[model samples]
Target: MRPNHSPEYVQSDNSLDVAPPYFFPNVDVQGFVIEADLKAVQKYCDDFLNLGTREERGFEYRAVPAWPFAQLLFLHYPVMISAAPDVVKGGNGRDSENPIPSSNPDFIVPMADRGTTSQNEVFAAIPVMRYGVGPKGLLVESELEWILPFIVVDQPWSCVCGREMLGLGKMMSRIDIGPGYLPGSFLGEVHMPGWDGNSPEMQHDLPFLYVQTGPALPTFRATEPLKSLATAFQAKPVRWALEKIAGLSNFVDDASLGLVPTTMQTVALKQYRDAVDPECAVYQALVGCRSKYSEISNLDFYDERDIWVMFNYVGSFREAVDVILGDELKKPLVVYPELDKTVSITGRMAKVVGAFKFSANVDFDDMRVLHEFDIRKDRKEGGHGQVLKRGSSDLTARWFRPLKGFFGPRPMP
Candidate 1:
């Protein structure tokens, strides 16, 4: 039998610099697991993830909400490269330009070089609900898949490739990770393009997110009694490793080491708006992406410390923050004095559940189109608007109608 080898999509013309199979070698990553509002996550799944599959296409991708938690990843790549099909197809000849220039829309910014270094990224991953559209539209429960609801990068190449190639919705932003205002603590902040409280255009300078971890604690000291006690409840490996490593018992119980070189199945909503019709999308679908990490080293887990996370609600980022942390009970952190009184900065801060840091080689590949939205014709015919319409009375108002004589206004008596 002959093996099949063909590029899925070729760089026929002056397209993007790289296609698929993005490689980020020796990536330094800081991961934080945050306790999220389940209701908000469910609503996010319904509106963002399930909108294309269930509402638009009339298929269901329900939110499982098994775990009410979200992942905040801060990645710094020492060297980043991708598989360039254009160069492979003999487009970069001796006479051809060394780095082909991409002239696209205003939003599509081309990267200077295909293989670049010092690329930084910060993203939020939410637990995707379990739903499957199998053969003949059969529903099947699948394993947990995560969705990148919010992500920002410092490189234009990363932004372009992420959005155009993988539907990652990567936005260009400035990220800072280092010593925080607190003594001996770590801080990570993202200042992306957003609008002021009242502005027509988006201001390119505004801090939208901030993550501060508690003071650094030693590995052995932090994990000793915690890991020893946790062995009784769960994480049986801790007890086993402790038993085996008699002399090195104190250091063997690092539970965070088990997560090194992780593999994550991520999903994104890929959509392109119609150039002519602003209300319609020419193409929209859910894209499934897989990222594999290997050659892991220097893994540090900080489960003992707490993470302080704040999401600033500015411009388009408000909806993204609302999806993860519901606006049920939020306390104001930063407030400015207005004309009459003080106004809090519109945002929410989440209590950190756990955090960890690691370095590894990351590979991004395996793109799959899970489900596509309905076509224009199908949408107009089969969508909810075309179905039967119904109305309901306000029950609360109706119940108070009879009490108008006693409690309600009777000629202002």
Candidate 2:
């Protein structure tokens, strides 16, 4: 909105000088200022007034970027104007079938499309059994392990998109360790906060730590191709976008532990896989890493299977295990993309939708005393003496101690 009052013009040595509070006050409109594009500013003002209306709402408004810029501009010179509520609501409308609405005065405002770019790629977490050099040049088969899904993207946010486009879920909850003396006992008692009987103050018995492995690959749904090619392209951008929104570091500590895959390696692997299998089918294109499972009751003493054994021994451990191993232990953890499920992408941006599934078994032998209570006086006074006399469960002078304090002394029976 332009100001109603006009500023006085004065004659300067070279040209006419406008006084304070000139039209478009505080805005540098000098012709010599080459950076200022008057046409663009005028269009923005016109659009602000006319575009966000009931009849013809603006498309591709890019609100993600535009809103902050508009706020900065408004901060300098506050303006208040009232118009139709739908006018300010732009981009793809609520319903996919009718993204943009016609002129309905009572039309409901739909969720705006996130005006950011995104990419897509296939991802999988397979159990790999491989041989590696041990301490004395002897090759040993690496313990049975599942590789966390590795994602890469030109934009870090797209990493999330690529994972999602491949149909992986979000991360599992933070792992909780319970007080225990042995690694096997520690594994068996490990639980997550908010789980049925676990609490934050419950300290782990052994020295141990665990981290989430980013988002997890989905298990229930059958494997299928990603919804669209555009979605596939958004994979990298989506990951970075998520990194920006929610710190990716919070999900996993990649720097300390070399668990997360490198960006270059992930990209290279996807390219190789896609090139070998152009169809881009998740299951057909990806190689399955064979997983071996031993029943909890039959595991060895020092094997990782100790976790399974401990888990079976304590029924409380079932909740966390069920999240990773699925409701039924008989079912193997399977990851595959689903073409039927799709996330809305805007300008390479998409919201993280589901939770991830992560499984980690921590084992350390070190022990620490958490808390202690003084019971020497109680022991000497027989405070904890068992009631062996055959009488009704009633108070008796022989089983009780009388108080001797400054207030008063009591006689013993």
Per residue, candidate 1 scores C-alpha lDDT tens digits across 358-400 of: 5678888867666665545344333544322221111112234
Task: Tell me the whole-model lDDT of each prediction, alpha carbons only.
Answer: 0.61, 0.22
lDDT of 2 by residue, 1-413 (tens): 22244353222222211111111111110000001122333333233212222222111111112111110000011111111122222233336676556663334332122223322112223222222233321222122222222212223333332232222222222233232344223211112222223454553332111211111122111144554221222244544443443224333323212122111111001111234445431221111111111111111111111112212212243332322223433333222121112431111111111121112211111111111112222322435344322111111111121322333464343
**Which portions of model 2 miss their true places by more than 4 Å?**
1-112, 115-146, 149-165, 169-260, 263-413
**Residue pairs with clashing backbones, model 1:** 54-59, 64-129
What 10-residue stretch in candidate 1 is worst by lDDT? Answer: 389-398
Cα miss at 204, model 2 (Å)?
18
Return the top candidate by lDDT: 1
Worst 10-residue lDDT window for candidate 2 reads 68-77
| lDDT over C-alpha atoms for residue 155 of model 1 | 85
